[model samples]
Target: MNTYLRILSYARPYSRFVPVYIVYTLMAIIFGLLNFTLLKPLFDVIFEQVDSEVLLSYQNKPDFTFSIDYFTHLFNYYFLQVAEEYGKMGTLFYVCLIIVVSVFLANLFTYLSGVVLAKVRAVVIKRMRTDIFDQVSRLHIGYFSSERKGDLMSKMTNDVQEVENTIVQSLRVVFREPATIILYFAVLFFMSVKLTLFTILIIPISGAIIGGITRRLKKKAVESQQSLGRIVNILDETLGGMRVIKAFNAEWFMARKFDEETDHYAAVNVNMARKNELASPISQFLGVTVVAGILVYGGSLVLSGESTLGASDFITYIIIFTQVLNPAKEISRAVSNIQRGIASADRIFQVIDTKSKITDPDTPLAFDSFQKEIKFEQVSFGYEDEMVIKEVSFTLSKGKTIALVGPSGGGKSTLADLVPRFYDPTHGIISIDGHDLKELSLADLRKHMGIVTQESILFNDTVFNNIAFGMDEVSEEDVMEAAKIANAHGFISEMEHGYQTNIGERGAKLSGGQKQRLSIARAILKNPAILILDEATSALDSESELLVQEALTKLMQNRTTLVIAHRLSTIQHADEILVVEKGRIIQRGTHTDLMQQEGMYQKLSSIQSV
Candidate 1:
């Protein structure tokens, strides 16, 4: 119940719709009850069961009162007058016309209530999905690393969609259905209090039976959602790594893995469906049994001549009581669906309630430009338990190019990531111009830096848009100039649409060198004061490498550059080269100075010379 209410609280400022919906729904229920209430008069007239004494009593208007009896008497008084003034056929037509009009108003108000509820559903979903997405966008990069992309995608898509389907469908059942049942039961009690009391006593038996079936549905629902996430994860991994799978001739292996997960997902859903499906039939059977009991009991009372329920009124009571089953069944079904919705809501709120570990301080320090050096003072970082970077310290003054040469898993990338505040250090302060990085707003800190990685992350967009990715309203001349600086202008012009050509997903349409050049172009357009290049040209061919290296040189000039490279030739000209091994800087000096030392740098330089 708490989870359901929490999910509903997203729909705020309900003053616009809730009151109007209440009025329409109440009118709908009242008129719908009127449809059943009129059945008694129509049956009495059809069977000619109206007593002559009762007819004469209805001629003089009964004194009006607040009770239902007063209203029934008032309607009967007018109905009998019409019958006497008109013929029997005319009275039949009059009663039928009233029934038709009541039915029409009932349906119309029902539709109006549905329209209002739909608007509320749409607003709730829009706000909820937007809030989930907003929280996701604000999360730290480390969150993505620790979580599956497909799992997150499932929460945003499948889980949220589940909440929409079940919760929105249950909304009407929660409000309108119970209101309908209550109004119908009120009429039943008014018709025959003894029979209504007997019927009410048996209703809880159906509820208890249905409740037992749906009790475990929530736990199964959670498992179903989780299994679906794993299936999505498998699908995503297969699609993203199709090249690797085919290259290794692992199609059968991938197929078997996918089948295993899908089989589990299917099994989980089957189990959930078994429980969910059982609730309806059990409730329905119990409802029919109760109705049968009511008929037998009420029939005896009428046969014994001890009840005020006339033949037509008893039939009307039975009709209205039977109508009660529909809403009761819907309520049972809604309970099952609400359980599923609560499970999905748990997953969605987990993401929304996640507190991002990386956030700017409440009172962040002011930072406009990089005037001095970036100093890492005894910085150490760990992923879980293992320290990846230990006591790492360095300083790169303005306009100086420093290269970090290291083997794989040597914390080069981790050290570079710290500069952009991707992950805060575990145990030290990284200060830029004597101001701690933690004290600066992330946006202000990253705005002055640009990064180009080996993967060359480019979106599937036009060349112009890709180059000017995050900027707003950039002029064409400026974009073209940035392309020229990155050595991408010539090839872009050679393409069929020049700057407007659509690059396929992740720049799939471009070659290795072209993609890297576009990445460099994007960085150049940002024109940050600090540049971080992580093996920018390591994956290209010789000719492509030369072109990309030239672009990098242009981008690195007159900037505080931090380069992480495996190729010894690329960093030999850097003002300083740090040889990092096992999370510590073993050597640090000018490239030539490091080469002169009989250490890791010289050995690596000698090996690359081969």
Candidate 2:
């Protein structure tokens, strides 16, 4: 319930509509009661037992509003006069007409209330989804490392829809069913408190039972929702890596894994459903018991002549008591639904409550230029338990290219990530132009750096948009110029739609080398002072590599470049080359100097040459 209240806070801006909805809902309930109330009098007149003196007293006896008083007085007066002249049968015909009119009005207002609720719920769903998406986007990259894509998708889609259903349905229950119960209770009490009180005894006992069931339902619902997320996660993983599974011929293995997860989800749902389904029959059975008790107890009173239970009043009382069954059943069902909704809300808000690990400073530094050298002094770092870089140090003087040659787990990429502040160094400091990297604003620090990684990620957007991705707005000429630098312009222009072509999902429509070139073009468009290339030509063929390498050489000529290269030939001409081994710089100098040293670099170059 607390989780739901937190979610409902999203509706604060639309508070005005809530009051309007509440009022209409209450009016609808009132109209329903009025429709029922007319039945007693209508039945009385029909039996020909309604005396004129009693009818006259009811007409004149009101310290209520003038309209209500006038209507009561006029209705009774006309009814008695008509009853005397036209007989009981004619009064019955008029009574049925009045009921039909009341029923029509009641349904009209109920429909209006539904419309209002739908509009409010749509706005709430939209707002909640947008907030969740925005929050996920701002979360640190580390959060994604252990998180399942499918679980996140489930939260965004299935969980949100559940919450929307809960909100709208719960609002309806709160406004309608409870009001129905209250209105009927008041009418029954006015009819006879002794009878009403006896029926009302079911309220507390039923509430306690419903309360206990709802608590367990909330717990079960949370478990079921979590299991659903797990199932979604399994499906996401299977689909994302289906190519690998097929290559490995592990279809049976994957099927078994999926079945295991789905079975868990099924068990959880069965438990949740069993608990939720308990609400209806349990409440109804109890209601029936209460009704039977009333029949026995109230029947004794009437037989003993201790109470005035007229045939018409007794009939009306029974009608009102039976109506109580609907409210009880509805409310009992609503409690379970509310519990499920709250469980989902709890999951959603858990995501919303997570504060991003990285955030901008209060007074951020503004820098439009990288005027001096990039320096790392005794930099040490770890990803949690394992130290990846130890006492590592380097200096990239302005306008020089440094190549890092290392084995697969030699912390080369980790060092590269620190430059862009993807993860800050665990110990020691990195500086740019004599200013600590942390002191400068994140936007300012990253703005001057261009990075092209091994995996060239591109969106399902036009070629021109992909090329000009980093800039706020770029001219066609500027996009073309960047493409030409990456040697992608020739191929792009030859495509069917040229730059306007929509690249399919994750640029799957393009060849691997073409995708890399587009990423290069995007970086080129940014025109950063510092460039970092992590195996930029690893995926390119010999022919594409030649063109991209030449473009890259020209791009690196006047910029401070850090190249993490696997192919020794790519970085033989670098101003300096460092051989990293086991998180330390074991050897450093120009390529020729490192080769003569007969160390890790020499062995790596020999292996590549062979």
lDDT accuracy of residue 265 in candidate 2: 78
For model 1, the stretches where C-alpha displacement exceeds 4 angstroms are: 60-67
Overall local distance difference test of candidate 1: 0.91
Worst 10 residues of 2 by lDDT: 59-68
Superpose all Cα atoms of candidate 1 onto the true structure and report the RMSD in Å to 1 decimal.
Answer: 1.3
TM-score of 1: 0.98
| Cα misplacement distance, residue 603 of candidate 1 (Å) | 1.0
lDDT of 1 at 280: 88
Q: 1-610 in candidate 1: lDDT tens per residue?
A: 8889988787778798889999999999999889889998889889998788978888879886898888888999889888998968878898999989999999999999999988989988999999999999999988999899888999999999999999876898978899999889888877788889999998998998899988999999999999888888989999989999999999999899989988998998999999999998898899899989988999889889878898888888888988999999999999999999999999999999999989999999999989999999899999999999999888888999889987889999999999989999999899999998999999999999999999999998999999999999999999999999999999999999999999998899999999999999999999999999999999999999999999999998889999999898988889888889989999999877887889999998889889
- Which segments of model 2 are wrong by more than 4 Å? 58-90
Winning model by lDDT: 1
